[model samples]
Target: MGTHVIKMPDIGEGIAEVELSQWHVQVGDLVVEDQVLADVMTDKAMVDIPSPVHGKVIALGGQPGEVMAVGSILISIEVEGAGNVREGSEAPPAKPAPAPVSEKPVEVAVVEPVAKPAAVPAPAPTRAAPVARQPDERPLASPAVRKRAWDAGIELRFVHGSGPAGRILHDDLDAYLAQAEQPAQNVSSRYARRTDEEQIPVIGLRRKIAQRMQDATRRAAHFSYVEEVDVTALEELRVHLNHQHGDSRGKLTLLPFLVRALVVALRDFPQINVRYDDEAQVITRHGAVHVGVAAQTDGGLMVPVLRHAESLDLWSSADEINRLAKAARSGKATREEMSGSTITLTSLGALGGIVSTPVLNLPEVAIVGVNRIVERPVVIKGQIVVRKMMNLSSSFDHRVVDGMDAAQFIQAIRGLLEQPACLFVE
Candidate 1:
């Protein structure tokens, strides 16, 4: 029996350390070559550490959320014949104690010293249901308790109160709910006092997201500007184009149109298409428009960059967005696909409300957030008319972009969207 040790591989790009996100094969589990043993998270991407030789895992070098240096021993495996690690040339990490295996959680309690009780049987006390009040009488409950009762469609007046002076309390409401007979859903089950909790270690992409978000907020002076855009003409154009080219190409979405508008709008606002380097005290303006589209995935929010928005047309940009979004969600997006953006665009689709203050993607000075489009009444010339309206809630690094410049930049996008033809015009 010999031991083979696997060290954390360098993820490259000057990354010194990475977080041990997860372990697929625990101690004593046999693994095959090319089988993923663990997952490590870099600042930009999740890299899978795979097994090179078939063996049984003997030790785990680190726990989840531990930042391990490159070339550090990751896992030790027992292999057939003489393994690469010979007779402890270097000391391996101490094997972690195995967790207690159980089907259900056990609570620890201190034994109390007490006198023996008498052999007398105790009878259960019977309490009648609280008398239901008249429908005209309002139940005395705090606003929060009343809100809960109101949300549950339970008239507090009909619910019996056990509080002093018949004032209803949250626990009283819980008791009433527990006693009530419900057929569709067992509402009483929700009244149970829960002592169970799960502790999820913040690791992988979630930790990276938290770090970047905190860094962005801490390093950059952020300010937000909101503007409403009338997209009646743009939506009509999108629908018409989709109708004509739906079979040949693909269905048109608002994303492609927004990208087109941003690309066009950036021509006049080159200052907004620049990355600010805080340490270097310098800003580099790029002619190319690399738009990072924020995608919500199973792991966390990832921004997959669209290489050059200027080069790709509407459908091409849409295709790339869909592809990158899929890759991000599936944890297949490359580091290149996730980085090097001059600006970012974020939207919550149907979930997007009237306004949202978005965080700036670090290094990039601006992030444009799209809100849901709604048909609202607006006066065109003299009379009130219904029009498709959307709001752009964008944030900028105040140190790099002035308030006036940010406002004008959003106004430019609004103009390009309102006049859809100008997005294609030079």
Candidate 2:
């Protein structure tokens, strides 16, 4: 038999390590070539690693949630047939495998003390004198319950155990703590109760987001600009288009119109479609516009890129945006779909407030935010009329894009949105 060690492949650019999310195969299971062995998470995307050779799995590297470095031994396999097997190519000595993945939390068994029967003759003499009571021994509780009691500085003996077999439970400790903090008689104080705090481990995508936002805030000088656009004409055109092609093509949204307008405006101002290289002290202006749509999912904020947005027509852009947004919210977007964006667009839908200052997606120079649209009285041609108005809040990296250029670029978008026909023009 020939033993082969498979290492973790580089999943994406600059990804040094990945968290092992799950394993499909276990030790001693036979696996085929090109078969998925495990799934690892990196760059906020799940990547499945396939086996290289058909063999019986000999070992697994680590458990789920463990971070494994790239090029490290991920799994070992033993294959049949060894015509050219190297000398001393024997499998390493086997060690006991880890506990099965289905095992529950670690449990420490508690041994209850057994009472022995006393002699009948001695029992009568013991009643002649009363024995002194002894202090309570350590309480019977689980490790977690004990830790909670310790953290709260409450003795388990003082708290009543309500669990099965008189074991102390977490709720018992909480009740005891609460009762002890109540005011005595008529004296009341606001700071009498102790405050409990929870600690959540910052890991996975959340940790990456925190790090990236902190780095951007420290390095980039952010300048925000807000402008109001009258989108009544655009909304009218959208309603008409949806009515005409609602069944044949998908219903249109304001996003696709905004995307096309931004694409057009980018042509006039290419500086906004650029990425900054801090280490190299250089800026790269991209000709192709890959717009990242900031989508909020149950997991967190995910930005899925619409590649070559500048080349796609209005309908095609709308379709692709729908597809990408669905994939991102459902946690099915690929690494490529989530990366390589020149700029970004964020919208809060109906929940969007009057205005918001969106943070810049790192390395990119600009981000456009769409706020809630409201109908309000306005003076058009010296007459009071209600118009559908929406605010466009945008942020730019001051070091790369000047304040004047940012304002002009947004104004250009406003002009297209107000006209509603220029977006469809060539």
Candidate 3:
């Protein structure tokens, strides 16, 4: 057997170093070709590093939360054929793969605690309800299997294993899920004292979010303005369009109309659609309106850009928004899809309260925050009537945008939404 050393690849745009978010395989674990070995975090997204050849994991170069440079050895695998490893290069590989870093985390699992078959006849084939193991035994499975079990809040200890050496496979998990009965909640559990603690390291995409939010707050002079808009007409128009063409075209959401309003309103307030580079002391007013739509995923918040919003119609715009949102949530959004926006739009949907002050997406001077719509009495022509009203809580960089311009910009959006017909008019 020979060692096949895999190096940390250079994920584009001249990134020198990246954070090792998590390792899918550890030493002595058998892995197959195309199996994901680790997940690396760049500025915008999480990238999976896959194995080139089927092998047993022999060594790990870095641990979770470590910042590794590009081209450095990532992991070493033991394969059947002559690997890419050169003669007398084994010693140097050990230097980069520190003894303490690689071996520590695994000790709590199979390496030192329960199972220690070096060429591991691992347990998890797919994972179901734990079965046929001691109380302290750790179940074996692939990273993907573990993730699925984790998301469902299922404990592997009770799961039955049917694979080689009693490894839990997907079939076992499916059987368990299909056949297992839900346990009843214990009455005394509510009052029981709890001592469980979880340590989530601020690494990967989370770390980037923290750094960017801090920088934006420290560097930019942020001020927010709140305005109320009567959206009864906009909702009617959206429903009408969907009722007429939803089967052939697609269903329409309030998001598409809001995006259209921004597109139409920006024609009057071009200054709001810009990126300001503070270090270079330059303000770039882009002709193209690239809007960043914020989406929440299991990992964290991601803003996938809607490129060239000025060009697409309402249906096309909705399709693009849905597509981008899906990609971002599924961890499939590319770097280009995640970057370069002149402005941002954030909405909390039904959870959007009366008002909120959102932080500006850095370099972009403006962000529009949408609130929940509620019907309330309004005095029109000295008569009290119920109308659907919502608030627009928007923020701007006070350094470049004057108070008057910011107010006027939101007012323009309000007029378009209130009228709804003006959005399509040239």
Model 1 accuracy (lDDT, Cα): 0.89
Mind giving the per-residue lDDT tens digits that candidate 1 earns over 85-119?
Answer: 76748646735737749988799997998979877
| lDDT tens readout by residue for model 2, 306-349 | 99988897789999999998998876799999888999999999
What's the lDDT of the predicted structure labeled candidate 2?
Answer: 0.84
Best by lDDT: 1
Report the number of backbone clashes for model 1: 0
TM-score of each: 0.80, 0.72, 0.75
For model 1, name the residue pairs that clash: none
274: Cα error in model 3, Å: 1.4
Give the per-residue lDDT of model 3 (tens digit) for 150-214: 88778877677777667877776776785565443333466666689999889877887898899
